[model samples]
Target: MAEEKLPTRAEDFAEWYNQLVVRADLADYAPVRGCMVVKPYGWALWENITSWLDGEFKKTGHVNAAFPTLIPMSFFEKEKEHVEGFAPELAVVTHGGGVELEEKLAVRPTSETIIGHMYSKWVKSWRDLPLLIVQWGSVLRWEMRTKLFLRTTEFYWHEGHTAHVSEEEAKEEMYRILDIYERFCFEEAAIPVLKGTKSETERFAGAQITTSIEAMMWDKRALQSGTSHYFGDNFAKAFEIQFLNKDNKLTFAQTTSWAISSRIIGAMIMVHGDDNGLVLPPRLAPIQAVVVPIFKNDAEKEKVMEVADRIFAELKTAGIRIKMDDRDNVSSGFKFNDWEMRGVPVRVEIGPKDVEKGSVALARRDKPGREGKTFVPQAGLDSAVSDLLADIQASLLKRATEYRDANIHNVEDFEELKQVVQDGWAFSYWCESRECETKVKEEAKATTRNIPFNQPDTEGTCVVCGKPSKRKAYFAKAY
Candidate 1:
């Protein structure tokens, strides 16, 4: 079978993304509609993310716990706004053992209701005021328009839920988690993002405020990478989660929920992937460095494999995820392309001649062509590989940030906003009214991404309604 070349991203970004994902052995469409079979490589990437975030959660006094995937319909109904928001996407189980259920069960879309119910039962006094728990599980949302990992019907994610005695504590937890999410995007995923509170219409249902980290993809579309919501006393009151205070007075608990999903994999693909294939960050790449032995005959193979094996062992001992490609049947060029397609951070090629010189040729995935390929001595190869991988990780984030910053435009009118959003992000003063937000969306197919928290304070008229504006909002077409 012949290998397929991915469509050029510049010509057709969507097709390019779809092809690269499968071609690179990340994931594939599942037998069920709107679902994806996350391949082993894809799962490994997710595992790396899960392990890191799980540690962060633990460090912040949060512990892992499991919640039932099946939530009673009555539980969802306890919170009217949440039920209304998730009703359309809920996958209800009406029957069990061939008998109709008395009350339908919903496959978990988000675990707020079930978790809230559990919290209400567990909390009774001020001593149990702060309940911090994290659930790593799959959620089913019946998305009408699915796009692999980005919008799959069943997606893997971690939802963090907490209960506090005071509203200030809940808000603090929300921002703390949001800061961690922003850090993960920039430090681990090599994607730069804007962090801020979502507009009223864009806030999560039943949330008093929603804060998110939004990233710009290569196509100039926004991707909501992760979100943290402050629910105040809304869900606690609805679910009857109450606690007696130090003063011996009962009050509703303040609640917060924050989540990050497999959709981040899609963001990484769009941000760093090129026409050749994926360009993974060193921190998350399943195989950080791959050793491809170059040989033309058995004699050459014996010489190259010896060095390749040694280098692989050394890198492994150095705590790097390294692989040695010693298959004699495959050509060296084929192995190179295979590793490149997989987005291994560094490729070390050891050939007979290079071995004779006591050195190895190194190539980086983030840079184009032979320009990124260099020769390093075998004596200090471990440090060389480490330095190169670090450079690649930093460079990818730098490149993405440059692209995102250059494309963001400040516009004063709706027409300018529409024109700017066609290619990139539009920053304009917004009236903070749903009517103006809806008009912008209906007219330009763009929505306010967020009201950036750190943007400078300025006074101007609304881009849509010409009304007095409270703050500048980012408007962009999003994934």
Candidate 2:
């Protein structure tokens, strides 16, 4: 049988992405507008991501909590900036029991306001300082445009809210989370990132600092994989979240919040997936390895099957996620294409030929080959997979690191900066002026993605106005 053909990315990246997402059967458009139905495969991938992230959070002393998805409009009105930033994207629920309610309740675009209301009632003393909590739940935003896993109306995410006694501690949480985020992406997802802080114009509303990890995709566009924000007593003041110290002084608590959502799935799709199909990092792949059997006659089949069974048992005992595909109806070629599309990180091929040779063919999804593929002797299968997985993980990170470098352009003039950012990101000396920011955005459909953290305080003129600039900032047209 002929293998199914996949859409070429060069033909149209947007269409190709859509085709790969739906064709791979990972997810589908939901009945309700702007929502997505994550299929078993897709949900399995998310589970893998969440399981890993949850452990990481626990290691950092962040406890998981639950929060409701609805928030009363009155709660939003308490924070001036939070209200303005999210009001436009809120979904209002005005009826209950088929009757109009007295007050409208906004479906959460975020939980800061609702969670803040609860904090006001719960916090009573300095001992409650550094209240660290995280929640994994669904959030709704009335998005104008929705992609499979990028900007859907409703998506699952882990949102963390922490309260501290001082602004410095609050800000410290932001950087700490940023570090975890960068390490997670590069180490687990195998996607390299540029870490930075958002400019005032682009910072989360009511946040004093917004730190982010930005990754470049195949389309030359940047995807914000994660963010950490410092509110610094802003929400505390708005919600009257105060505690009394031993000095007998009542002080509003400082707060910080951060999140990484299903959007990281989209980033992984764009970063590692190619024209053929999905190319997942081994650590993130739901099915780490699949075993496909090949046979000819009854004698050959029995011999291959016996070896396959033994090999599968050994791999499982070694703590590997292994699947045995013995469907006799379909040819092995079809299985190869399907599994490749779904991004099974490794494949073990056992056939009559391999049984006689006392070895099996090993194929890696991320690193495709055109010539005679490699194999590992039966005794070496376990060790070979361990080495291959580590190599693929590092390979993906190196590839993305190169893409990030290639897309980032440092322009000295406004006109060049505008041209450069159209395709991807541009870094240039910025004066940190909102008016200057507005001028740049007006001329180019780009915003400051971030003021890079710990960048050299280079002495250079602003790309737009020729005035002295203190720091360099990354500008990009984002997803």
Candidate 3:
């Protein structure tokens, strides 16, 4: 059978996303409603993401621990805002062990409530206040509409919860995590993002401040790549998580929690994928390089396979994740397309002639132009491939950064804001009022992506209400 071509992204982006996600072997619909079965390839990508971030978390003084998946109803009720925010989406467990229970249990949508409860018990004095714990697990949120990784009811993520003696310390921890997330997205995923504080209406439930890293997709819609929340003793006071200060007085500890989820995989697909398929950043690709040996006959096969094996071994020894394809049943054309769809960062083609010439043809997945491929001699081939992978990674980030910046528009009035936001990000001064924010979303289907951290704090008139504003807000149609 001929290989099937995915729907063109320009014609239908949503359909293209769905087809590419499945065709590329990333994930699929689960048997259960509103869930997905993350296949091995998809899980491997997530694993790489987690492992990289995990090191960063540790460097910042976080240690991993697991919390129970189920939370008691009383825990949710402890924080009024949190309960109100998640109540409609809670999945209740009325009967455990096949019998009725007196109090209902809720599966975790996020782990703040439970982790806060634990910290309340584990902390006693100022010495124990800076408790940093990380959990890698799955969370379930009942969703009416579900997309694979973007809005799934059940998904995997790493959530870090910490308590500090002072509000200043807690705020610093929150910002520190946000910085780490920004580095991960830029360096590892090759996805450029806007870092800023979320508007009050969009901030996390029960948080005094919420910051995020938002990345724009190919369709110009924003994807919230990661978030850091500063609770400022909101949950700590609610849960009565009191700790003795150095002055010998009891006070509630400040709290913070941050997370990045499987949804990042979706963001990567949208940001880097092309009509051909997913174009993975070299750093995150499971198989960084795939060696496909081409031979027409037994004699040619023997010689080509010998050279391919040697090259693969050299790359492997040099700490590159690679695979050699020497299947006789399938044509080379099939192998090429298959690997391309899988988004292998680099492909090394070794034919009889190339083997005889002690060289291999290298093709990069990120570049669709003629310059993507080149012939490199086998001597120091491993170093050549490494340099090529680094170039591909950097080029992907440069292209994405350029696109994101170009789509951002500076508009002075609501009318101009609405016009530019139809297909890109609009930079305008917002009054920071719920009424004005809601009006913009209701009329233009755009919300405040963030109040960027580094933008100048100049006085300007609000885009919608014409009121005095403190800073420019990033507005966009988001996922």
Candidate 4:
């Protein structure tokens, strides 16, 4: 069969993304428009994500639960602003069992509405101050623009909702979830992110504060990896989620919720993938390392298999996700292309020449710029491959950090801010006026994405209106 070729990233970024997702055998468009069918490889990657994220949620004292997919329209109206913001995107069901229903139920655009209704009932006393619940499931939104995992009609995500006694505690909880999300994406996924709070106009519906961890894609567009909301009694008041305090006073409790979805899968593809295909981090890669046993003929096949099986067994015992390529129909060159396309962090090739020479060839998928890969001696192949995986993980993070640093810049004026925002993040002094925020967005096509946590008051005029500055806002054109 002929090799299927696709558009190069330089040819067109959008085309490159679409080609990579399908060509890598990750996902396919389902019969439903704007929705995708995650193939085995893509689902396996998501399984890896949920496994790690669920463990983190458990470590943070959150319990997992399932919620019904369809929610009553009345439940959505409980939160006033929430309903208005989400009403347009909702997919509602008006009939059940071929009969018209009295009240229409909407497929959850987000679980906040349904979950808020449950939260009201789940709490009644001071003892229920902190009701932490998490759910992992698929959600539907009538999306107009869909790009595989980037933006889909139906996508899987793990959302966490926590209720608390006061706004102070809720803020802390919001930041805590942000920390967990940052750790998961940056540390495990090897994607660098910028931590900041979104501007009022960009904040989540009904949230007092919205904090996000934003990562820039290879296309220079920002991908919102995860978001945490500090809802200060807004949902509680709407849904009547009140509890008796220690002094027997009825108070509307505070709530916070956060989520990281399969969107990270899209971010991962854009950040690390190349013309070849997806380059997943070793820690998150479905197959960390693939052993491609090179054999010249039948004389060497049995011996190579013995060595390959031994290496695979050792890695498996070490709790590594490993694969061994033992097919006889394909040549070593074809196997190399296949594994590289899948972006296995490490590939070990052992053949008759290496078996006789007591050395094996090792290849790092990332270091292609090094001309060619170096060999791993038989006595040291196992240890060397382990070290290579670690190096690849660290190298990817370092590369992305440099990209982030290069893209993020401080702008002194409107023109400077406009140019900076086109490429990446621009931290500029803002007058803290809603009008100026709107102006920046209107003229530059960039919004006030966030007010960074670490930024202190500075002596500078507003980048847009040249008024007294309130905060240094990070502006960017987002996904």
Model 1 per-residue lDDT tens digits across residues 323-434: 8887878777777777777888899989888999998889999975677799889998999999999999999999999999999998998898999999999999988999
Q: Which regions in candidate 4 have their CA more than 4 angstroms from the true location?
A: 1-3, 369-372
lDDT of each: 0.92, 0.87, 0.92, 0.85
What candidate 1 gets wrong by more than 4 Å, as runs, is 1-3
Residue pairs of candidate 1 with colliding backbone atoms: none
Q: Lowest-lDDT window of 10 residues in candidate 2?
A: 367-376
What lDDT score is found at residue 68 in candidate 4? 93
Error of 4 at 327 (Å): 1.8
Give TM per candidate.
0.98, 0.97, 0.98, 0.97
Query: Candidate 2, residue 440: CA error in Å?
Result: 2.5
Position 374, candidate 3: lDDT? 88
> Residue-wise lDDT of candidate 3 within 1-479, one digit each (tens)?
23488778999999989988888999988889989999999999998999999999998789999999999988998898898899999999999899999999999999999999889899999999699999999999999998989989999999999999998999999999999999999999999988999999899989999999999999999999999999998999888899889999999999999999999999999999998888999999988999999999999888988899999999999999999887899998888878888889999999988977888999999875346788889999999999999999999999999999999999998888888999999998888999999999999889999999887657898999999889898999999
Ranking by lDDT: 3, 1, 2, 4
- Cα lDDT tens digits for candidate 2, 189-308: 999888998888778989988889988889888788899999988999999999997687999999999999999999999999987788888888888888998988788888999999
lDDT digits (tens) for residues 320-387 of candidate 4? 78898899889988788777777788888888887787777788888642343777676755667778
Residue 236 alpha-carbon offset, candidate 1, angstroms: 0.7
